[model samples]
Target: MDPAIASKVLPQGLRNRLSASVRLAPDPRVHYPGSDFPAALADAHILISGWGCPALTGDVLAHAPGLRAVMHAAGSVKSLVGEAVWRRGITVSSAADANAAPVVSHTLALITLAVRRTLSMAAGYREGWPAFEARSGADGRTVGIVGASRIGRRVITGLAKADAGYRLLVSDPCLADEDARLLGAERVELADLCRHSDVVSIHAPLLHETSGLFDAALLSLIPDGGALVNTARGPIVDTAALTAECASGRLEAYLDVTDPEPLPADHALLNLPNVLVTPHIAGAQGDEVTRLGRYAVEEVERWVAGRPLLGEVTRQALPRLA
Candidate 1:
């Protein structure tokens, strides 16, 4: 973690609790691998990691003979944890569960706006007020979830609890028909979900198999005037195909992530009236960061008490997880 983040996450009070429970590094901010980093790891039993923490490799682990565990204060340990850490039998935990809450909430809010055609309406305001018949209702609107991930599951739960009576459809390889029913959703193939959904929200991980998953053909399956919402990794959707869809005014989108993130200045998607392209702001940020900090602190507490980690990450499960 960066030094500034270390201070915010482990303010004086939490730092004291950590110190009382176990030995801590004199400085908790080890963001990079360097000579000083190895010396700092000497005699350390655990590492408190965060967003900027460097990858743990063989050379780095050689210096920390006593390290047994790592508690990360951020989501996605894919970049933070390497083969060396797992080979050493070191326990690892992530604060992804804490991070999922804000993403789900933000995504749901976007869905609400999308279902009502807020962007298209606002874009055409200068022309004239939309006729009553042109306005859409949220009631009985079909929403499709592309992945049954942590965030996806929470979004399904949110849809179930909403007063709008949304019809939920989910497409995930691992989700069974019974499981979808339990979540108040219908298990459908991706193409079927796209064909039926009024709003489609993506919550899948970025993997070799998932890259460009929403290409021209799949994206074309969406009904006219439908909206697409993406809070997941950018490459999962075809950037060029999406631009063409929104360019023709056939579909609307609320994209929090982009294939070429921070798309070029003249990118078509940036200027589209019906598309809401935001920098990735759906996850924890500002005040919400405290939740990740609190979760990491509790994980550390649990570890000290010899309890199973709440956010445990095993090497075998990494490929299937976000």
Candidate 2:
């Protein structure tokens, strides 16, 4: 893991516990495969990896003969894990569940604003106050969820319990009818969801099949003046298509992640009044960083106690996970 994060996440007390229990590395430091990392991995038994850590390739694993478990203090392990780690039977865990809470809350807040046409209304304020007919209500509005991911399911539950009484529609190949009903959502095809929804919130992970899932055609199906909220990975929605939609004032979008992140400073999406492009801030940060630490600590304690890991990740499950 990056030494900077390791120090803060595993404070002295937790570090002492970890050190006392296992043959932890003398220095809880080792990042990518470069520099002094090979020497650090020479005798390490368990690896605590985090963001910016390079992939654990076969060559890298060769340096750590005793490494058996990996605890990731970050969200996705896609960039860190590879075939080599799995072949070695190395157990993996991630703090993605811990990170989902903030993203769900941010998405829900955006949904509330979307239902009320907040952005468009605010944009139009400079011209004049919105007419009574132009204003929209949150109550009974249809909200479309692109995937039944961990965050998506939570958003569904939150929306279901809200006073707004939103009609939730979800689109995911893996989501069954019973599960959708139980989540208080109606399972629908992507096109139908877009066509009827007043606001569409994307929660799908970025997979080969899901890449460019919301293309020009699908985005066009959304009702005029409808809002699109995506806290999910970018590239799932075509940036050009979205730019054109918002530019025309036909749609509004709240984007925390963009295809080409930090979007080429002068991108038109940045100037659009109805489009909001944030710097991928829907996940844990600031005070919320402690949640990740606590979750990782609990996971480590469970692993030490021979209990099942709450944040465990497996080779078979990685493809479908975010």
Q: For candidate 1, write residues 166-206 as lDDT tens digits.
A: 99999999999999999989999999999999999999999
Query: Each model's TM-score, in the order given?
Result: 0.96, 0.96
1-322: candidate 2 lDDT, tens digit per residue: 6655666666677767666567666656545545676567788767777766778889888988988888888899999899999999998999999999999999999999999989889988999978899988987899999999999999999999986878899999999999999999999999999999999999998999989988999999999989999999999999999999999999999999999988998999999989988999999876576677767777777888899999999999999887
In model 2, where is the ten-residue run with the lowest total lDDT? 26-35
TM-score for candidate 1, residues paired by index: 0.96
Steric collisions counted per model: 0, 0
Candidate 1's C-alpha runs over 4 A off are 29-35
True-structure Cα RMSD, model 2:
1.5
Model 1 residue 243 CA deviation (Å) reads 1.1
Model 2: how far residue 291 lies from native, Å? 1.5
lDDT of 2 at 59: 83
Candidate 2 off by > 4 Å: 29-34
